[model samples]
Every structure is written in C-alpha cells, then in structure tokens.
Target: MRKPNAARDQLLHDLRNAYEGGASIRTLVASTGRSYGSIHSMLIESGTPLRGRGGPNHRRRVP
Candidate 1:
C-alpha cells in the first residue's frame, strides 16, 4: 500500500519505473485503482516515452 497523498515526484517515479519495466498503463491502473486518463497523463507529465499500441513484438521483422 502507498501512503496517502504521496508526493508527485514519488508517484511519477513509481509510474515511470513500472512503465519502463514493461508494465502497461492498464496494468498500473488496475494495481493503483486509478483511471486510464490519470495514468496516461502522469506518464506524459513524467516525460516517459509512451510505447505504441499492440505492446511488444506486435510485428515481426524480416531477417
């Protein structure tokens, strides 16, 4: 459980870390009980480069 009223920086750090670690915003929303818009906004606010749709390896590369 997180402390109520956690600092913005701290929350952003956690959100960014989770996102970078391959956890999607939807996953975070489920875990954090926050809305999709809230999660998306925070990721943007934290300057975390958002991933494209369909997640990892959506398309295969020719070798």
Candidate 2:
C-alpha cells in the first residue's frame, strides 16, 4: 500500500493531467475513485479553472 502523502500526490498528478486533457468532472470522479466534491475542491485548490456546467457538447438552455 502507498503512503498517504504519496497516494495524494499521485491523485493530484492524475487529476491535473486528466483535467488538462479535457476530462470532465464525472470522468475524473469515475477514474480517480474520488468524490465529486473532493475532486472539485482539489481542482479549485490547484488553480484549475472549473468548466461550466454541462460538458463540451452541452448547449445553453434557450431562455
């Protein structure tokens, strides 16, 4: 088993790479085995700009 710090660091690295590569939060959560809130917070703490609601193909609702 990996140490706590090492595991965290690996998670961060994976998260950064996945996010930068355009992976969605859902995707990250699935792949990382992390909670949505946790992933969201990590991204925020890492200075990663959060993507707007919906995904790449998501269209804004017509008013």
Candidate 3:
C-alpha cells in the first residue's frame, strides 16, 4: 500500500468545499497563498467542476 497523503487530501477537500461554496480560484489562491496555476490545477485535479470564465459576454457585445 502507498503512504497516505493526509495534508494533500485535506487541501483538496478544502479547495473542493470552497469552490463548491462559490469561492473563485483567484480568491482561493489569495487565501491559500498558492499560485494561480497551482490552485487552478488543484481545483481540476480535485474535480471541482470549475465555473465558466468571468466577465461580460464579449460575443454579445460585438454582435
């Protein structure tokens, strides 16, 4: 059996909960002191079902 990674698992859990609680990746990065890419990758690895990108609909505006 492999050694358990409690800390990493907890981080993944916390990230997942925070994400499901509507916390943005940027916000999570700031709060967790983790890099944007690292946090984003973690969120994906943790299966957070990332929300769509933020900002106004440029396609709608250009139409």
**lDDT per prediction?**
0.92, 0.82, 0.89
Q: RMSD for all candidates, in order, please.
A: 5.8, 5.0, 2.8
Best by TM-score: 3
- Sort the candidates on TM-score, descending order: 3, 1, 2
lDDT of 1 by residue, 2-45 (tens): 45565877999999999999999999999999999999999998
Q: Judge candidate 1 at residue 45 and give its lDDT.
A: 83
lDDT of 3 by residue, 12-37 (tens): 99999999999998999899998999
Q: How many angstroms is residue 35 displaced in model 3 relative to the true structure, after the best TM-score fit? A: 0.4
Lowest lDDT 10-mer window, candidate 2?
2-11
Q: Tell me how far the alpha carbon of residue 14 in candidate 1 is from the true structure, in angstroms, after superposition.
A: 0.4
* Per-candidate clash tally: 0, 0, 0
The residue-by-residue lDDT of candidate 2 on 1-63, one tens digit each, is: 745687777777778778989999888999878899999988876678777776378667888
* Model 3 segments more than 4 A misplaced: 1-3, 58-63
Model 2, position 35: C-alpha lDDT score: 93
